[model samples]
Target: MGVKEGSVLPDKNQQESYIDKQFLAAPVKSAVDKFQLIPEFLKVRGLVKQHLDSFNYFVRTEIKKIVRANDLIISRVDQSIYLRYKDVWIGEPSVIMDGVTEKLSPHKCRLSDITYAAPIYVNIEYITGSHVQKTLVAKNNVIIGRMPIMLRSCCCALYGKDEAELARLGECPLDPGGYFVIKGTEKVILIQEQLSKNRIIIDTDKKGCIQASVMSSTEATKSKTVIRMEKEKIYLYLNQFTPKVPIMAVMKAMGMESDQEVVQMVGRDPRYGALLLPSIEECASQNVYTQHQALEFLEKKVKKSPYFSSPLEKEGRALGILRDVFIANIPVRQNNFRAKCIYVAVMLRRMMEAILNKDAMDDKVEDYCNIPKNLYGPQ
Candidate 1:
């Protein structure tokens, strides 16, 4: 019979002598092969000189991106502030050495108690008084600021040097350098791990109740949104809602009108079905079954609180929050009720899974509400 497709066939490249394959024995009692194996307790630490190449590359490339992302604006009264940055560059240090400009050396910085850094310059242009466009500010390069350089990096003075050249600069031949010089001291940048921002994280409390939270942050605003389960009821804590608002009210405001859909979204079985009963019953009792009614309920809640000055302003702000509450880091219509429905469904799924799977309750936690920082030395 022919071999069927999708079957694992034995490889035909095996090559072994009869004596070697049939029996294996050591040539000597304590013999070892030099190229055969390595020990399990051995560790491999990265070379510092090797890391300098990569770190310097990031400083040159990523610094430009960081600067462009946060560009500065200087308004001018005499001339229009039309000048904007085009490109950024790193140049040699302009420190005066016998009335001549020269590149900074790591040894020189170590002896002088100064930093080993280079000048950062930018190419800029703007319109002049004649309404003509694109004029440079200076005859030559324009200096912006200084950037610290890593020792033995691509732009370092000792880079690409031979033994004689390295000795000429007063550096040890065996030294592998990857550090910053400041005030005649060597500083090494350590790695830091942080929690991801602007996303939902589901966790269980000590009582086994599920909590879904998101740290919402933008350039100008930051708020922590939390939805927690307590006493068999789901509540949402958000801005301007002094009393925790019902998650069902939020769902209804997002246009999930049918209680059947909400209950079925949670699950159809008896155990899961019980989780949605209280929320659905509360939604029904409040008479907030339609989108318009839900918006009015939210408006009333916001207006009843003492935060807003007038009814009209409170109503407007409540409406805005009802429409734009569930999204961040992306642009969409302000009142995209469909997106909110999807978000509600996902949150419900997380809670349902946490309730059904007992094993999931003890899963590892990545709750980085506050990070711990360690101090290395006696300082």
Candidate 2:
């Protein structure tokens, strides 16, 4: 209680404080400023969370997929060249130079002005014509080439070291490691912000020209298949179709034999039917009807330097070429022809919707190419 006028009672700050030291837990403090300390802790946390997964994915999955994709083609090439070889498999990754396996360190890399990379080993077996026997190469690991390694990644030598150990190994105590040590240099792979891959990106320019492209990426291939609307006509660059195949021809090629069917597949809407009329008419003018005939027309459009040996060989090549040209991941086990046709139909439907809808044309849609799970356009 205040006893004097203009005089304050004992303030909370002026009050005496006491603690029994024996009962108190050990005090914790650091030399670093609290503000600075927080940011440093956050920096490490951020690095760990924002870690790039590209390297790990590339090694574990992408490398194997690449090998598998090429295995058959390599085998066939060897057979034609009179050399016999089996499938290919990548071996344990290592860093080797001139028949010597070496430890890859960032400091050494920087000093030597060399990239901190590891050899991509490939295990392969071949046969001798005289013996007719499979012979394993002396070295199971054949050096394919060198690939850059990320620092502190599973592959890095310093990965799993304690702080004290890190210092002994010439690492900074405060350095939150997410960078790659290239030839003794601290290098980092910058975090890049990009549109989702393997999806269609749709956007329209100020000129009112609608443009769309699907970045098709499969285990074996990556391609930016583009389609654009110019002069009120849709021009598609789907796998081996010509630069400007009219929309109707593609529809017809995909087993849309009649205008009514094409119109129905697009939608029951009268507007959709009207939008398809020009394409259907143009398709009729080109006379692309049956799949066989449509394929033939596509084959004619493909320009090449070396012609095939025989009609059978040409046709066989055409089959593979056509599939890869317009779409991907079509296995012999499935009804690829039908599936691809349907896929194209759906693609056309979406493209047409984007072309017609004023809002969608102006608004950018990432991953826009794929049909939604609903199998129907927005109401």
Candidate 3:
């Protein structure tokens, strides 16, 4: 039979559209054999593939029920597939393929998609410096995230200069010793097992401010916990482990009298002498004697002199005089001891000068000894 004119050959436009759709849907695979066209075609095709896959997955998994109601039309354009479910049209178009699936709308369809992951947590412990406490608290605003936080309170009263802020917080006007807690939304995760492995001992007096860290508890078993009280803050630390002999007994053992005169001479302020006097008397009751030895004990008192400024220099001069006048010659009488006291007197005089002329005195000792008043005296 002769072929009829205008016989319906497959619609060339439709065929071309199908092929184009296929290329757009899976550009990488579709262009694999077409080396020359692959580079340009696959570039865009690959970009749209992820979104297209996601859309396809969503359609199959989430929108399948809606599709059965005739509310959706799944169409193949060239090589690409598209869905139009009622007013919403989602697909990878042939001309634009950048891994982005479009939801066609009358005005504009934007894929405002978001994905979420799990959250993380961390813990930290640190000592607190009062000066830095407020600043550390202020840092909470900047470091965002749900994390439990804690910090030790500052141990000193003079932490920050702002007394008003400290007072507002009702923190001890003197010093507040405690820990600050910052609870987050989630429960705090503590590594208790790790913490348990290590041991820390804090020794404090009755007041509870930590004084020391001891290796073992027995070292300080008998001593009462010493707690230092400053203002209202109480600091607890381990007491001296074993009360050896009292300070006076120790002085007596070193061949010195722990008497009031000796104690006062040694820098123990007479104001506290009453409390320490009995300790000295007890040492005298032990018969550790010799006037020179007594003088030697008194020398210890002078050694601790309270020439507040330049104390070391004053101490050195006093010792030099003691050694030259009394200690150098044994069996020295009380009068000779008094004569040697002149060196201590001179040292005291110089110490007073150093305190007064601290602003002007140069490194030279002579400069410290020379008095401008004496030079200009009775002129």
Candidate 4:
């Protein structure tokens, strides 16, 4: 039969290879071939591109959010005297000398043995004095501090400059600039790798106890919550909450009062019920069956904190710890802890799984595999 127009013919080599393919007993691959595309990728996006991007984000966006988060500052002695940050920004690279301000360059800074940095300006509103004569003042473009500028960042003098311009500025055209020039010294910050935040990890501890841990992180706070099995009973461990608490007690404190409700929330599996029996009995042994009773029990176990001065303030200490400190990333709005309670339940279920199946626990190598890393900067 004749081949039709616009029809494709398979390559004889490809067809033959596919038909005669033999599976390898061992998986073997070429390392050079595996990374061959890296250079091409780096050509388009330079090696230090991420660092520059991160620094630029910090200067342009993250700093503003940080300022807004900590915007208000009240005088300790006089509550009425306060300062509020309106806005913040990173100015162009510059230097002040002999009552003269001049544009600064990385080359000049290197030769002069000075840091190539930019000025941080902030707009603020403040009330001066607590008396009736107190005045509200608004200020703009006030120099707050100097921040080290990453070379080739948006704020850098050499940014967006061509090779000829770079040559005039005494900068190497091939130098991928992501380091800070402090006192004429080049400092490259190594990116730090760590376990991801707001993630639950189930693993076995050195003491042979299986535990579920979550490094909860939020804009306001960062905390860790751990649910571990010890002596066939589950306990909750969180910093600032002295002494290990029974898992059932913590569940009840978060308003899961009924044992059946707690068990059902964990799972419908009968194994979960059997595993949670010891923790539930421990809660009962301590007379922490009701939510009120659980709160009161936790209140006594709370470590003394500077925040709680009076008995009225201390009354809500346990509730505050649960709402703010424990699994802090899971926000509890208006004292509603439904989400937090569910998270704890999930942690408990994961802990049970780890205890039941050794393979269910996290592998140390695998745990580090996908961790997010960050270059040292404002963050």
Candidate 5:
């Protein structure tokens, strides 16, 4: 007889539940007893599983933070699911449900909840040799000036991906100014911003000068307070003074016969004037007669100029031209070439001294005569 149209089909859910119950009940018939298994399986394994679970949760949370505020669309193909975040697509293990396929629509999905906004500002600073002045202010989204502000010692405020690692190792040199609002920390951010804005303003001034008003503070009756903001021209004065060279050395180097001549020569040369006088005064402190002896010895040393084969030959060739001029009795301009000749004579003396002193040669005349006669005059 044919089945009736209203007859009910066997329940698939009941069959699956029966199979599962049978499998569980039949599991006690194993050849190996449960008590005979390794004890670590119950303790260490359980702890390991728990630790793995915690680690997995941490990783998932961190990944979620990275992908938050971003939509993820996924598609299943074979053994893998192709996941897409914005324009990026990735593949991972996944399962398919029944014969149905679900696709994420770009327009319907919402972004993850992870996102942050950061505000950037400009910092301005005026720096001299010994002092630093700083200011910080907001910046608009436009280039109002063409000139860039001068930063004495400036660098970016942001620490990139490696900053944390570097900090952990105590290798990071970043100034944690704006990141914290503590007493000294607050100033870093404020100063950086101020310097940035000041540069922009300076660029806009057309004269390359910062004309912005800076806030100043003054001591009051009970407390310190901001008095007023005033605009001032920034000035940085560098120390240009240098200590002078010793008088004995100057006399020796110049082949000067007297201290007066050394002073005159130094005064004539601005380079020498800045260094020679002080050095001479210091050297004079050793002994009065020794100072004079040093000068005379230096002068004698200066008279014996050394002649190198290469440079001396070249100089000799040039001097040959001058010697010809002198031989021709041509009135060469003395003042223009006199100082140059004197410098050459001094250098020659120093060169000779360097070589002879190294060899422990006491006789200056003997060594002086050994130099090429063509380059140096007859001994």
Candidate 6:
């Protein structure tokens, strides 16, 4: 075909139009023209701000929660002999020299090849006498242990110090401190990312069976609870239990005796009920038809402890383990397992969904945008 005169010739205006349309350009401004916020952000929250915040939270709040979880210690031999922790606090860093206690600084710890740590003190009330003549003794500022101090944290001596003050203490004034001095060695804890806690994660196991898991974390306990299908039956795997326990049996032990109630709790969908039927039948096959029978069945399955040997004690210990360790993120108050049973049912529902829809199953290795990554300080 013969080319048009303007298209073949490519006039000056057409050439300009072609350039403008094919290659677009915009005015470029220097970074100085765009207000710099990074410097200001650095000044407000330094590079190590996350580490410092985590350490401060650990010291001021987490430590108290940890202490409160194990506040009372009762002797096994003599129940009357017990110790109650009233309060706990971290003391200022100090060292004893020639029987004289002197304040310790991070610089001194580095030079002396010592750890920069503070003493953890607790107030305690205890019974120190016979059961018939028990005497309650209260103690104050009892030293329990030493905790390494994270520099620049709220509990650190240099937390709010100015440049001149930091220089006076032989520290780098420009240092963004979020590390520990351990035996004269500077230790920096890098942030680590892991699967979320107390959230249901549905994935397939090595055996190609759909599973739902939770990394349950509480003040007193941290455990992994998983419910997976095996040969058409659901099973629970927890550290405190034996190899595995039937999911329905676990529910029944948690006061969910009726299989119909368990199915309903999971969902009204027929697909969910179908997936749970095998587990329910498995529980029945084991003769676990009631809460007491379920507990008795689990009593033998729980890891045996030397502390609980008697029949009654064993039964109670088994129930206690289930209540305290199984899906521990859900609180079991006053021996109530209603919430825990519901949580298990939800896990089951998720697993059933994964089975029904392959896309519903979360990949073992997931995208960063789909997961939460949290930075934590040293324990």
Q: What is the clash count for each candidate, in the order shown?
A: 0, 7, 32, 0, 22, 0
Residues 283-347, candidate 4, lDDT per residue (tens digit)?
Answer: 88998889999999998889887867767768788998898889998988988989988888898
- All candidates in order of TM-score, best leading: 6, 4, 2, 1, 3, 5
Which of the numbered candidates is closest to the native, going by highest TM-score? 6
Instruction: Looking at model 3, report the run of 10 residues with the lowest lDDT sum.
Output: 370-379
- lDDT (tens digit, per residue) of candidate 2 on 173-219: 56555566565567765543344455555666477667666656576
TM-score of 4: 0.84
Best by lDDT: 4
lDDT of 1 by residue, 1-379 (tens): 9999899765555433334643356443343652343342222433563366466655567656655744545444434655666677777643656987766788888898888888878876654554455454532367788877777777678778888999999999767777778777888876444334566667776776687766664433356666777778888777666567788887787777777777776666777668877877787798888868887777766635564566554656665665544444322365666665666666676766676675444233354443222111100
In terms of TM-score, how similar is model 6 to the real structure?
Answer: 0.87
lDDT of 6: 0.84
The runs of at least 3 residues in candidate 3 whose Cα sits more than 4 Å from the true structure, single-residue gaps closed, are 1-204, 207-242, 258-261, 285-379
lDDT of 3 by residue, 24-95 (tens): 677455454667775776666543343334333433343333333333232322112223333222222111
Which portions of model 4 miss their true places by more than 4 Å? 1-29, 74-81, 131-135, 307-315, 368-370, 377-379
Q: Rate the local accuracy (lDDT) of all candidates.
A: 0.65, 0.58, 0.31, 0.86, 0.29, 0.84
Residue-by-residue lDDT tens digits, candidate 6, 1-379: 8887677676899888777643335543667734575687788988988887878888889889988998999987787899999999999987767988788899999999998998899999999976678899999999989899988877788988998999999999888888999999999877767777778889887878888999888789899998989999999998888998999888888899888899899999998888888888888889899999998898789886787766656657678888788888898899889988888888888889888888887764665533555655533
RMSD of 2: 11.3
Quality of model 2 by C-alpha lDDT: 0.58
Q: Which stretches of candidate 1 lie over 4 Å from their true place?
A: 1-102, 119-146, 152-165, 173-176, 196-201, 205-209, 213-226, 235-344, 362-379
**Which residue pairs collide in model 1, if any?**
none
Candidates' TM-scores?
0.54, 0.71, 0.16, 0.84, 0.14, 0.87
Q: Cα RMSD to native, each candidate?
A: 10.6, 11.3, 37.5, 5.7, 36.2, 10.9
What is the RMSD, in Å, between candidate 6 and the native fold over all Cα?
10.9
Candidate numbers sorted by lDDT from highest down: 4, 6, 1, 2, 3, 5
Model 5: number of backbone collisions = 22
Point out the higher-scoring one by TM-score: 3 or 5: 3
By lDDT, the better pick of 1 and 6 is 6
